[model samples]
Target: MVLYLQIIWLYLPIGLANIFASLSRHIFPNWDYPLDLGKNYRGQRVLGSHKTWRGLIVGILAAFLFFLAQKYFFNHYQSVRDFSLIDYNSVNILTGFLMGFGAIFGDALKSFFKRQKNIPPGQPWFPFDQLDFVVGGALLSWPLVPVSGVVILVAIVLGLLFHLLFKLIGYLCRVDKTMI
Candidate 1:
């Protein structure tokens, strides 16, 4: 049980990367530089205007900050270290960067596919929208972390649940345009 909790805790930063990216639009309203820079493939936008540089930077930075906080807690609290998946002391910014990049990149990759399918931005893509970051983060962190397949599966499921819960909260609070 403790191990499961630890996995979910460790996965939080990765799972929340898309949320931070979405919130970045509000933080930097004027910086709407699309990552694809108006590029298109097969007569379709490679990645819609929503996948901006600002969101990517902010998401990665947020994840890095979150990792630092986790490291600080791990150093100061035995309980944190006891539940950690990695030695916080040994992990560096690269870990956070990979996790964040993987997540945001995953979302953008999904957006590419979503565009090909003619799905509009901000529209939910069902489980793909929820699981993309989980799979991306887990795959990217696989070489760096010592996580088991079970932990990865659990994290994916937890990510999906958390995404749905947060979407519902955002909708109820009138902060989001839609709820998945």
Candidate 2:
């Protein structure tokens, strides 16, 4: 039970980053973070429009802060005596940033496919759209802390389910028009 909780805790920052990215429009209306793909198959934006410099910055900052707090809290409590499993405080920050960037990158890749398919942004696109960010985030950070195969498999399944649940709630609350 405790190990499960610990694993969940490890994944929390990236999940929060995803939630923030989803809500970024409302959070920073002035940014005009291009959700629509620009006409030109230009240098940078070629990747995807939704994946903006602003979103990347915001995501990285959020992840960094979250990890910093988690590290600070863990240090203060000294609860996890077996500290070998966890990395140093600096490592947490680095890994958190990677997770954040990778998550946004994954979402952008999915958005690219969505545009290619002419699928509207908010429309549902099944497991690919749902799990992309989580997979990217986990993969980016996996080297830092190699988890069990069971954990990786569980993360993929759980991430998809969580995405569906969040989308349902968002639609019901009028936070989003649809789930994708």
lDDT of 2 by residue, 28-79 (tens): 8677556444643433334455656567667767876777777777667666
Q: Would you list the clashing residue pairs of candidate 2?
A: none
List the lowest-lDDT window of 10 residues for candidate 1: 10-19
- The lDDT, on a scale of 0 to 1, for candidate 2 is 0.71
Clash count in backbone of candidate 1: 0
Root-mean-square deviation of candidate 1: 1.4
What TM-score number comes out for model 2?
A: 0.82
User: Candidate 2, after superposition: displacement of residue 131 in Å?
Assistant: 0.2
Candidate 1, residues 98-157: lDDT per residue as tens digits?
A: 888889988888999999999998888998988888888777877777778888888888
**Model 2: runs farther than 4 Å from truth?**
33-49, 80-92
